[model samples]
Target: MILKINDLSVRLGGSHILQGVAFDVAETGVTALLGRNGVGKTTTLRAVLGEVPATGEVLFDGRPALGRATHRLVRDGLGYVPEDRCVFAGLTVAENLRLAVRVPSPDFDLVFDLFPELRQRAGQRAGTLSGGQQQMVAIARVLLNPNRLLLVDEPTKGLAPAVVTAVAAVLERVATRVPILLVEQNLAVVRRLATDAVVLEAGRTAWRGRAADLLSDADATRSLLGVGTTAGRH
Candidate 1:
């Protein structure tokens, strides 16, 4: 396993956000973390990266990483892409990618190939790009560096169908090389890309199994996600 969490718990401002959440991510596959809003999906990711105060055992490559700083986590081969697509406003696309590299890696060519628009717009300011383009910048930023695990929080939220397809393809390619702990709500993308899934309800893991199993079990989906809709709908 590339990542492991056991009995993870978190509280914020007198509210319990995570309650003994635990899950494992393998070295080379995408593990989708699925849940409705305000269910601590984001908090779980933050706690894993030490962005939120929590009590837990986080093991990366079988080593304890509970209290490590955020930069240390990145330096140790962890990459994160928040839902907001936080790219530097004044920086050019190339500059943003250059700044995200924690270690020397000769993967710039691969990054450009994955998102050709970034290469064509290398000199454009990151803040001016469209939402999909900015998302590409964020994902490409992590690709420029060496990574064993990626924590992606909702890559397709608010994106057009075409853009979602594009980003999904990039994520597909990324999963080929590094393990991904993805928190995505798009059931279609989850069904198409995720090998396994861990569903969180009220900050605790409620289900764990193959992605296909969850997709096929409509009762399980409606009970866990509060939606009876099928994949690729709404």
Candidate 2:
């Protein structure tokens, strides 16, 4: 396992948002974090990165990862792509990607290869770009770093159908280079990219198995996610 969370629990603002959330991420391929909205899927990722106060054991690369600072975790080879696609609005595309270069990597060519438009729009302000372009920058930024695993939260959120397709293509190429712990609601992307899955329900591990099994079972999908087929796009 590349990542492990044991008996992880978190309370924020007097609410127990996550309780005993536990799962394992393999060393390669995407592991989808599936759950309905507000079920603490996002919070679970936050806890692993130590962005929130939590009680539990988190192991990264077989080392105790809890209580570590976020930057240290990244330096240790963890990458994060927030759901909101937090690109530097005022910065140009090249500048935004440049900021993420914590260490020199060959990924500059790799990222641009996956997202050629990023190279084309290298001079454009990020805020002025479309949602899809910003997401590309967000994912590409992390790839530029010396990262072993990527924690991606909803790369398809709010994107148009065409944009989702494009992002999925980029992510497919990216997974060939590093493992991905993906938090995505789009079932189509999950089915195509995820080899394993950890389903979250009410902030707990409701189900865990191969992505193929979970996705093929309709009842389980409806019961846990309250929506069938994360499949989208026209």
Q: What is the TM-score of each candidate against the true structure?
A: 0.97, 0.96
Candidate 2 residue lDDT tens string, 4-23: 98999999999999989999
Estimate the TM-score for candidate 1.
Answer: 0.97
lDDT of 1 by residue, 1-234 (tens): 899899999999999889999989877789999988899999998998889999978898778888889888888888999999899979999899888877655489889889888889999999899999999999999888888899999999999999999999999999998989999989889988999999999989999889888888889899898876565454
Q: How far is candidate 2 from the true structure (C-alpha RMSD, Å)?
A: 1.5
C-alpha RMSD between model 1 and the true structure: 1.2
Total backbone collisions for each predicted model: 0, 1
The whole-model lDDT of each prediction reads 0.90, 0.89
> Any idea what lDDT model 2 has?
0.89
